[model samples]
Target: MSDMPPKLAEIVDEFASAPREVVLEMLLEFSDEMPVLPAELRGHEGMEQVPECQTQFFLRAEVQTDQTVTTWFDCPPEAPTTRAFAGILAEGLAGATASEILAVPDDLYNRMGLATAISPLRLRGGTAILGRLKRQVQEQTGTPT
Candidate 1:
């Protein structure tokens, strides 16, 4: 896997080291930790939907002047697994620099051992989330693709 920001790397390591059953549990915990979007950002113009996911998942990312990134996610409570993926990205990548977000490997979830616990389709959704996050980072940072 590529070098990830310290916080995101820590989360990936946590999942990697966890037992199969615990991985799912930890994912759900992340779902619970998912923050609601601030009222002003809710339904904002820049938010984009990830069509690859079975459930509706929308996200918006902002790269600050200092290059730190802030990501916002909207997923229904009923889609705990999808919400968990968003939670992981939001919590892990929040405040991470654009370069750090860009460096994260596309297949980091596989390294986390999540494949053993979640469906292949769900894992694909996770990959889509990361893809969208990276695109937003590049857009905000004005980095050429």
Candidate 2:
């Protein structure tokens, strides 16, 4: 419901020294251990990693219901689309896909003046993946979602 994309951008800016792929990998690893959705619903896992510091993020949402969401994380992009950890969990929000992640222009990195070492994971929830996870729970459970 909020502007989560910009927040994620802030995170990308903060950890400008860690490899964006590494940051994204760590995020997915954590997300899987603690699925953004109900643990009983579905499970999250890392599928693949692409060049340009982009990682493939896959979500098996509604596993019990046969629903799934998969997307990509591009460290740098020409247009720089934004996606917060929270916004990703929003019911209807389709997070980045593998192809989209790979589609990022090679110039994105230089354009953003970001180093390949940028961590991509922000310490604060500026992108707020955790906050988004909590909100997602509330929405799905109807208790806080």
Candidate 3:
């Protein structure tokens, strides 16, 4: 797997190093940490949905003047697992450069050992989330898809 941004790498390491049972607990903690959308984005006007997710998950990425990327997620609280995945991405990739975000491998969740804890379909949701995030980064950075 490709080396991820430092913050993200730390999260992946945390998951990879934990016991299988602990991974679910850690994921739930992340769910609680998922940041709320800013007031301006509350209505989900421009955000794109990850249809692969079992829950209604929407996200948007903004590339700042400094070229750092900020990602926002809108996930229902009841969907803790999906919300946790979004939390991981939001916290891990916040303030990372667009190029850095784009460099993240598509199978990062697998590297984090999530496949053992979640269903294959849930893993697909995580992958879809990463796909949309990367796509937004590419669009913002003028990188060809």
Candidate 4:
């Protein structure tokens, strides 16, 4: 959780302290919190696909003129684990500055204690999600990496 945005660090703290069952439960809870793709971004037109996920995953970010970010994700309900990863991103990164999002460490999931719960392959998907998200923010706002 080092150098994470405040909200994201708080989320990682919760996961880090939770028991295994509680962590998984929190994942589902976050999954439910994930917002639907706004009508404008639906149909996967501008979204980037996360093929690393076993399930279909797509995400995109909008960087406002103020350099704040708004993230979006699309993952079917059936794929709760994958959806939970997107949920974490949607919750953790929303409203962060472009640089804040870009600076998020790639090992965030392991820091959050998710590596012990989810498979390595799934962790790879989560990593990809975060990577693409930061890239999207950087591309939009020209935030220096």
- Model number with the top TM-score: 3
lDDT of 2 by residue, 49-121 (tens): 2222233333322211222223222222221222333232331224522222223232333323333423354
Task: Candidate 3: give the clashing pairs.
Answer: none
Residue 47 in candidate 4 has what lDDT?
89
Residue 133 local lDDT, model 3: 91
Candidate 2 Cα outliers beyond 4 Å, as residue runs: 1-4, 17-37, 43-57, 60-115, 118-145
Q: Candidate 4's residue-wise lDDT over 46-132, tens digit each?
A: 889988889999998889889888888999999898899888888887788887887788898999999889899989989998888
Residue 25 alpha-carbon offset, candidate 4, angstroms: 0.6
Q: Please identify which of the two predictions, 3 or 4, would achieve the higher TM-score against the true structure.
A: 3
Please state the error at residue 37 of candidate 4 in Å: 1.2
Error of 2 at 108 (Å): 7.6
**Per-prediction TM-score:** 0.94, 0.24, 0.96, 0.94
Report the number of the highest-lDDT candidate: 3
Model 4 residue pairs with clashes = none
For candidate 3, write residues 1-145 as lDDT tens digits: 3546899999999999999999999999999999989998899989998999998999999999998988899999999999999999988997788888988989999989999999999999999999999998898889997
Please, what are the lDDT tens digits per residue for candidate 1 over residues 71-104? 8999999999999999988888877889999999
Q: Count clashes in each candidate, considering only residues at least 3 apart in sequence or on different chains.
A: 0, 14, 0, 0
Model 4: per-residue Cα lDDT at residue 126 = 91
Worst 10 residues of 3 by lDDT: 1-10
